[model samples]
Target chain A: MGRSPMNREDTTKNRILAAAGPIFAQRGFQQATVREICDAADVNLASINYYFGDKQQLYIDSVILAREQRAQQFPFPSWSDDTLPEVKLRKFVGMLLKRVVVMQTIPWQVQLLMREILNPTEACRQLVEDYFRPIFDRLLRIVDELAEQPLTDLRRTQIGFSIIGQCLHYRFSAGVISLMVQEDQREECFDWDELTHHITEFSLAAIRNLGSHVAVKSSPRTSETH
Target chain B: MGRSPMNREDTTKNRILAAAGPIFAQRGFQQATVREICDAADVNLASINYYFGDKQQLYIDSVILAREQRAQQFPFPSWSDDTLPEVKLRKFVGMLLKRVVVMQTIPWQVQLLMREILNPTEACRQLVEDYFRPIFDRLLRIVDELAEQPLTDLRRTQIGFSIIGQCLHYRFSAGVISLMVQEDQREECFDWDELTHHITEFSLAAIRNLGSHVAVKSSPRTSETH
Candidate 1:
């Protein structure tokens, strides 16, 4: 009854999500307007209600769409393959950084996700658990295997943050980063290749240095004193 | 005349900023309303209009207030002391992460700053540059010296991201992180000490490795050759 190869409901829903991607990225979920999304998609305001049931659902769908796109573009290879753990770790870091930065495939979606992390909405909570959390867990496992010791959940989570943070910082704060580096010669600007390399190497070293005792102790005292 | 301070303008401005601090941390800048701020401070709404001129300015003042507090905490002596680079770096990472995670000293200003970074109002542009950028640049230099290389700006920046990402990821995604570690037998789920150790080691290794590059350049037009 809908268009060929797609249900009418699914097609309309996808269109709404696609339209929301950039707006949410550009202006956070708090600021994005439903009317603007409808206008951008060239669909009736009622289409959102019919397909997804609410504005919040549309946003969740948009986040899912972006996550799928990122996963596809940077497909997670089986670490079961013969590559060394370090090499596998490096390649994964490279692929992630490339997809996250050079591609800019889902810039706004990523920003929206960050917005949720910084200031959670009910919608962000749902998507983060179902979608991003699993991927992060798996990635942490991979890094832990390459690491000197098995990590505590807290350590695993911290490593996950480090890898992602290094890769996404420039893209997430492109304007601020550009300004910060403006005084450097034009030839010395940030490059994706070099950026990925540094992140891979730095993160690897940091993980390898984590002691075996990390899983047992929980102290408010900082590592800075060392 | 203002209540008690020598300078009435400074008193009023500081009061407005002081009131704005917890409100912004709790509600975020966009969600924080002027009336709520006025009510909390026990000051007239007109005073805000009179002194800072607008809601955005009050927000900036609050951010600056928090930033100044943090800057005063991370003194240059922390880095420039006779301690070895690795020791200094670990200490710095631990100190910074503790400050970010503890929630009392620095508050949640970092999250607010990051949100503004993602979605900047004109007011935040200069504030970010003035407060955060220089600190990051200093971080880059510290990372560079630790690595013992004349790192390219790209390399330094990448390492900078790694350190921060590793450090801040736990607090930023506390919801997911808490869940990830909740199953552990440890009575206190979030282990700050262990997290700091893992991140410091991971970051140090990554930075150390950046100085050495071993990847062979492949021919641009080769069909396939190892």
Candidate 2:
């Protein structure tokens, strides 16, 4: 059977979104024009207005679409009920790093999300709630299990931010990081497994120390008498 | 002897640099124009070329000038030789948060540095070496003192990155974070004292646990058989 009218409209919409993602990512919301998106998508100018109503709506949809596409392509690893929390945490960190740094198949989605982060537009709140909050909750659950004591919400939030901050640093400051370290060491630090291991171990050590059983020995180097 | 020729030239150079700092910070390097800077400085068109050679050099000088100005204005807290490493780390994290988040006296410098970080230009290398390297070294030294065992260069680097990452997150993602959490919680989090305290404790705990004496307990909640 031939494609129905609704199918043709959906195809047109998908084409526009596909074209708009990269253009919006590259030029940002202000610089990116509907004309350019339409031209890139090879659709008529009316088609954009007809399908998306306006540029702002188009942008919001594009961001959501990018999130959906990335989630589908590189879904978070599934862990069975028997899996250890530490193992799950490790996998979570690795999945984050891989999706962010290694998955080159959808570079625009990452870039768009990052740009939204650095200079968020109206769409940012939706992006955060829809895309980031779920992942953050997942991380918090894993951290809660790993912690020796029941963590306060504030402490849990701080711990979650710490883990995410480490992952994001590699993406934002990869250039500066490479520049700061020696050439030989850059590969080792940036290597997917190495960075993931470092973050997991660092976080785990800290979480374990939060327990009352562990006495955090004061530095011997401290000259002040306690 | 009124203003000498050399003194007059220096004043003109200073004016251009001051005017350019905000413009470059506001508009970034590419969008910021020489004419606007010259106008803002109330100098002749040719003065930019005469003083700083060109727009690119002028941008570099302005960044350097902003760095020097900020450093002088809000110098990092100096620790006495007898100061405890834990205290030093707390002070370090506090100083960083104050400079990045609370110090409203010179907002442009932070914005300019952040813009450079997101979309680094040719000046990024110089920025990293001249500004970041010294701070990184200081942090490494502090972390070294805190750790019970001697950290490898890679571990030290990772530790330094972890600390810096936590501090930087508040500045960059403050908007998203505020949106993520409840309104009442926002004040507690963005409170300079609270954020600094959280980061310091979190990092210190992690560093202390890295010692050989501390046994990292496996997650009690894990159901998996090891």
Candidate 3:
């Protein structure tokens, strides 16, 4: 059990992060103000300064906290497990989708992190290295184990890019996706279990056929220019 | 030949769009000012108001112009032509990557548009339908022809989401990707031919496997239960 003061400190910091997540998600980093954050957290402005220095540092802390929460919720799978590669990949996908889609659990800090990705700042580079790259490397190792021809690191990286690309498009283009699919509930449509099943089946097929070195016989060059 | 005044007017509009694309890309919509746009275009601020009703409309028009230029450069294969599905898909991927990857293009507009999607505006809804839905629909039809399962409309929509997801990941996570991938020229690593080949092959494998309906065997539940 934690001491009373320690628990209070933890609770206060978490409350600030929880409040900041959605606001940062909605308004973005530059647009969001320190006063607004303090108000949202129901804490004095001094508390934030005391705990995390300034607004920029507070924002960074919020992101770090969210990232930690995500990791804890969806910890990296053990490589030693005897699970089939397909099943492992599917679970990974499901966990990822759930983390991204469930707004109640996810803080707005993630949305801010994504913003930095599209238009990066100096801070984003360190964030990526510390938090994101390892997860991808883990993903690549899993794909390599499953692939037919033993994917080169380069190829695995590309596949990783593709897998993530497919997953994130829904989050990035929710409005267009809703219109195209005729779904009233956009958030609901990104159902984790269902999407995980679909992508796993799809991505596994893609990886299985890769690096087989099979000759793709093209139609005779009609122009004969070459 | 066009009359001199009309030619001048067209040229001025083109110049404004050209300048605005880079400026808008560097600084997002909120930050990008009419004064900055006019300064970059080497025109009076009054010219922007004359050419397009206001700054918002000007930005939209600039994006449209960029899209038109992309369509011209990477014209879609004629549906009338008896092209192979794989060939068509590969070409489509190439066209999409080329269009989206460029620093100066409507693809940059796409980045701006993505920001709005995370935190939508009224404008995002209309823009989604007008600009983006049609693109997904076109891609879906191609996947439909290739997929072995006779995929339902919902499945096709999901697949469409995945394709876009993978393709756009580069722009979406540019900073992180550059750091993580061990390449000399980080940007140049997104090779169109290679990437398109991988995506097309991966998508094809996934589509082909849909016919089999082989469910992956599950592993024993992990100790860390949610």
Candidate 4:
């Protein structure tokens, strides 16, 4: 009897989190209500309060859970010891595009993260520290390796942003893009492989061309090592 | 007396628009209320109904006005006959970064537009057609000039998005960026001139490197002309 009740409680908690992710993503923190979340979850109104303490707590928990789920679903591509920087970059860009644009199976997590980014609330701080910072650091390392010259941290960061910005544009402004392009062009632009290829090619060309210029001011570390 | 009353009415109308722009931008269309707007504007609540027909109309008018104001404030740089494609591209990127990141005197316009983009309402379609499309078309023309070989319209559009995506990232994710970079690096990154130089160099290098590849599959027009 005790085990049955505990399992039921766990089920209700999981259900509430699943329901809350989409609602909070769609409505944002200020607009989403606990009642709506409970109704969507098919749990009693009191269940949220019992399980998560309050609506804010539930929202935070839901965001964290969604981040974990997304990371697992589209984990970063790992490079082997012999992998070339160019190959690693292509894979990185492809993985990022997949995470942003092609993952139609579970889009709520992306939507939720985008919503937080646009209209950030308290949970945004945690989301950035826990979820985004590590990914950013990894991207920086990849960019550093790709550079022919030792880049200033600032330069590396800007390059990383440029690459990420291209991928994110498709997600945030798909409607605007579709409206701007010709009807036929829209179909071509949205093709997953085509868009990924364009971005990777575009970024690689820039990185290769600019890498020499960036190395113009060699770091002390380079001189010392040489 | 007739002109005076008319001028007073016009003043009242403008006041409502100015007040509503920030509110609608901050709270979005659904959440922003007429009463709050009236309170902020220090106008009679009836004035909104009397002047603009409804809150939606007022919101639309404010958006239009803000767009006009922004365009006038930061008009796109005009290229001379003697300007090189490389120079023009650099100028275009610099001007765009200025429009997006440096013009902080009045940020409400950018914020309003971004909010509409993230959670597009009916207003977004008109905004894109009237405001964004012209700018996009201009960008396409610029990108076309920079390419060694003629680019497909779709390729031109993707390149434009890539350029714009970099500029918009700073505005939308300033918080996340500030968190990611070191405190001193943040200061350097946000320096309008330094950031503009970096983005321009980054984009130009990429465009130059990718231009030849983009021309590999010539469009029907190229074949026809040849």
True contacts kept of each: 0.49, 0.44, 0.60, 0.57
For model 4, how does the per-residue alpha-carbon lDDT over A1-226 read when each residue is reduced to its tens digit? Answer: 5344553355888899889999987777778988899999999999999988988899888788778888998788876788877777767777787777834443888888877776677888888888888888888888888888788777788889989888888888776776777787777787666677677778887888888655442332211011
Docking class of 2: acceptable
The per-residue C-alpha lDDT of model 4 at residue B198 equals 69
Off by over 4 Å in 2: A1-16, A30-58, A102-106, A213-226, B1-13, B30-55, B102-106, B213-226
| Per-structure clash totals for the candidates | 12, 0, 5, 0
User: In terms of TM-score, how similar is model 4 to the real structure?
Assistant: 0.89
Compose the digit string of candidate 2's lDDT tens values, residues B1-226. Answer: 5545563365878788878999998777777889999999999999999977888999888777777777777687786899899899988887788777733343898888887777777888898898889988999999999988777888899889989888888777776787787777777667676677677777887888766543332343322222
Clashing pairs in 4: none
Residue A36 error, candidate 3, Å: 1.7
Q: Rate the local accuracy (lDDT) of all candidates.
A: 0.64, 0.79, 0.66, 0.77
RMSD of 1: 4.7
**What is the CAPRI rating of model 4's predicted complex?**
acceptable
For model 1, residues B1-226, the per-residue Cα lDDT tens digits are: 4365453354656677778888887777778888898888878888888988888788777777766666667554354566677776777676666666644343666656655565566656686578667667667767867866576555566567667765656565665554444465232334566656656666666555445542222222311111
Sort by DockQ, best first: what order? Answer: 3, 1, 4, 2
Model 1 residue A175 distance off true place after TM-score fit, in angstroms: 4.1
lDDT of 3 by residue, A25-93 (tens): 667777787788889889888877787777788777666766666678767655447877876787666
Tens-digit lDDT track of model 2 for A88-181: 9988888888777633243898888887787778888888898789999999999988987777777788789888888888877666787899
Worst 10 residues of 2 chain A by lDDT: A217-226
